[model samples]
Target: MAELQGFVFPRTATGRSSILPAPPWHYSGDLLTIEYRTDPERVIELLPDPIEPADDPGAVALVWADWQSCSDTFDELLDPVRAQYKEVFFVVRGRYQGEHVSRCVYIWVDKDYALVRGHYQGYPKKLGSIHLTRPVAYGKAGPRLEPGGRFGATLAAYDRRLAEARFTITGTADQGGFVNSHAMLHTRFLPAIEGAQAPPSLHELVTMKTVDVDAGPVYVGDADLTLFDVPGEEFGRLAPREMIGAYYRQVGATFVGGTTVHSYDD
Candidate 1:
């Protein structure tokens, strides 16, 4: 007979801490993205100073992803459900410091654990329901299988449809030369404690950070996007002029650290 050890773990307001685990967090999964051209004026209105919309057709990309993520501290291999979840994000292409970059405008996830983890990394993630449909085969099995298939996903918040997208898979290709941009930028704000006389004149601060990813094999495809009536005005502005392209791919990244590009006091 095996004996179990009884131990108590520290807890916070949210739950157990998943941050102190360690480095080299591994995330492997499929990402289906739909790209759309938008008004350059609207894109400019959304970007902060030192960031400008890309010269090539100002575009926004929506991504639907299902991942199996783990870290050195918590090998999800032991319990897959603990680390597996679905996510969706709306991003815009922009330029920073003379380099093309992508900035996340909004993001949603189905799990609280993922929400906490993303927030710590400066990703503006919010709690929502995301459903990503797996790729389905179209024809016969084996070598006779059709060259293309289909993928789809939907995102909802507050019991309302935020957005939904469908993609027609064409074939697989190298991760390079794809419309999917790898560089990302986000802003983080630390506000001064209100009515704290002891702290005196401590200033509120805001900072911008960028994250770059090296993607793996990419699946090329065509996509269609449907934007629904959401609470935010920004969501309405994202209505696609036209879908430029779409692609699917498996991704892996080691989130190390970020550089603070800008800071402002309240």
Candidate 2:
């Protein structure tokens, strides 16, 4: 018998790094997103130093996505249940290291594996219930202009509704690539182990970016948003000002290794 490499290990016996999956996680999914304006001052207050909210209009994009993700290896694709999951996140157009970028304010997922993997990549992901709905109607008189053809998504946690987004496809354009080109920045933090006196815990705040993005068929539309009073929900702070635009599309991307841009503590 030959030795098997890259096999899963028990987390209790070995730390998360013991069974780390190889790089270039691949994902394909339908994304329904809404761009809206919000108060710039509030948005700025929420951002970390060196990351400023966009000066254009404090634009915030909220997305609800249903995705099937797997490692680069083909064998992993056979397990659909382990690969499928739902996500809802809010991102603000911001400036990072003097460059325009999109920074995630809050994000949630329904899968434990995703939660762990996302956190490792600096995505501030929490466990929650995310429900995404696709438009059932197609062709002319497509979902955009029809009264009941809207795509929607809802986020809830601890039995409390956090937010909801509804969008109707109005048109299609080749600009999907442009709209999805923004680089995403997230913070990664690992606390120091307790009772370790020598080197203090890892308290540094780091930034990570996504690469090799391939966006598919972007549909433009109008959307309406409703935010609820969830105690810990950060999305409630922005308070939608006006609808900028809405979109529905499919995207495939490889989330390879990330580069650390800034460090907060030493």
Candidate 3:
């Protein structure tokens, strides 16, 4: 029998995937997190049907991270370049079924694998340049996790700066200060290739599932953000109206996959 097999794309006879490895992908990273209040109407526009704005309708968070990731084999750890990537995302609060959930509106990642992996989990992921200040124990100019620490992060695509953030740490914070204290909502959409005028072949509301999740200590701070009015991007619509909170934290988690909550096809 002749066959080709793999969990991801470009399958081989030996069952080796060309782009991504097997499941249970793990990640550890340092993040610069910022929370703010955007326009309520803007939030309404981004959230899909049946998911209305939460009590704090205009509330949102943007996070920039420098990450190190690996699959089951964890071989990428040894080849650090393969494992290192940076990403930034914007998440808004929505109420679904009387329950609060987080919805990621826009996200940018540095690596192709990270983009593809994020797409699988229903994130609206795009490729971009993401940078953040990495904290060090001996850093004197700022970029430390302790009090008075200052960090900066930036996101850019197509040679244009889209957004940036700066956080100045005041003290330590608990999980409650974290923006995503609840589950996140997403939409997995695969457009139809069979027909030029056909609708998306796969479209569904979904929620991600993570295993061995660790919520690391958070550094609370005053945050400042700027969203550039890019010619082609609509993310600027969610421009900050009021700064809410900021954080610097370390996180570790595994991407186990997700479950569909609703199918538009039905």
Candidate 4:
């Protein structure tokens, strides 16, 4: 598998802010038991049908994407991709109010999906024979993952800075600050894969429908992704709307991102 790549936001005055928070999949009991690839086709299918602008000038645009975590299956998915591709990249971004920010996560891997199961499971799988489950939304700390070496180190640095900012006297210390960053990451990956195919027209994609799939809560474990680091391979790219359209087909999703062609209507 590729090395885990992410951003490390500067610490806020309070000491509680991180660009990479505990993703929803960590505590949601989401089984990291699915496989994915940079399939432009599948990304299109996941998007919602574009809606006509409401007469009211305040209607927000809608979009959809999937999320998973580091599980046994994730290792399965990475085994093959690790051998096939020299590097695996995860892209993310978000829009809030009137501004947008994005980032890229790049890793080194030769093959793709040699160890993963089929399809990306965005939600928690229902267990017919399971006993109890924990649905703990992160508290002030945000979220936690079983940290490894390299990837874990990066996350730790980010988490420490975030914590410092959160506790700063002048800062709000609320998880709100990181919200936009995380949202940007989630949204950023969408375009990464979305543009991989035909590359959506500038205006076509930034303004489509989004559906939030019902993902039941899940619990996740930690895996060591530091051993697979490739210096030049770990990176990120942020683009403007105009430039964004240009990259649609240039870079697709990572082998773990997802597969399956989709359209706004699908």
lDDT top scorer? 3
lDDT of 1: 0.67
Put down candidate 3 lDDT per residue, 1-266, tens digits, no spaces.
76878777888887766678878899998877788888899988888898987887888888898999998999999988889999999888888899999888999999998998888888899999988988888747546678887788889999999998777889987653435677989999888998758989899999888889786787888888999998879988898888888888889999887888889988
Q: Which lDDT values do the candidates have, in the order given? A: 0.67, 0.73, 0.85, 0.22
Candidate 4, after superposition: displacement of residue 1 in Å?
46
Worst 10 residues of 1 by lDDT: 202-211
Deviation (Å) of 55 in candidate 4: 32
Task: Tell me the RMSD of model 1 versus the true structure.
Answer: 6.3
Off by over 4 Å in 4: 1-208, 220-227, 236-266
The better candidate by lDDT, 1 or 3, is 3
Structural similarity to truth (TM-score) of each candidate: 0.78, 0.82, 0.94, 0.21
lDDT of 4 at 180: 15
Ranking by lDDT: 3, 2, 1, 4
Which is better, 2 or 4, measured by lDDT? 2
Model 3 spans with C-alpha error above 4 angstroms? 139-142, 176-178
Identify the runs in model 2 with alpha carbons over 4 angstroms from their true place.
1-20, 135-148, 176-180, 194-200, 203-212
lDDT of each residue in 195-240, candidate 2, tens digit only:
5553545444455444677887678877888999777666777888
What's the C-alpha lDDT at position 132 in model 2? 80
The 10-residue segment of model 2 with minimum total lDDT is 7-16
Candidate 1: lDDT of 91? Answer: 80
* Candidate 1: tens digits of C-alpha lDDT, residues 1-266: 44322111234444345332444566777788887777767777777777776776367778888987776666676887777899998787677778777777778998876776676565778888888766544544312112466666899988889888877667776652333464666666434467544443322212333234456666777777888976752577767887677777767766655656655442
What is the Å distance of residue 236 in model 4 from its true position? 10
RMSD of each: 6.3, 4.5, 1.6, 19.1
Name the best candidate (by TM-score).
3
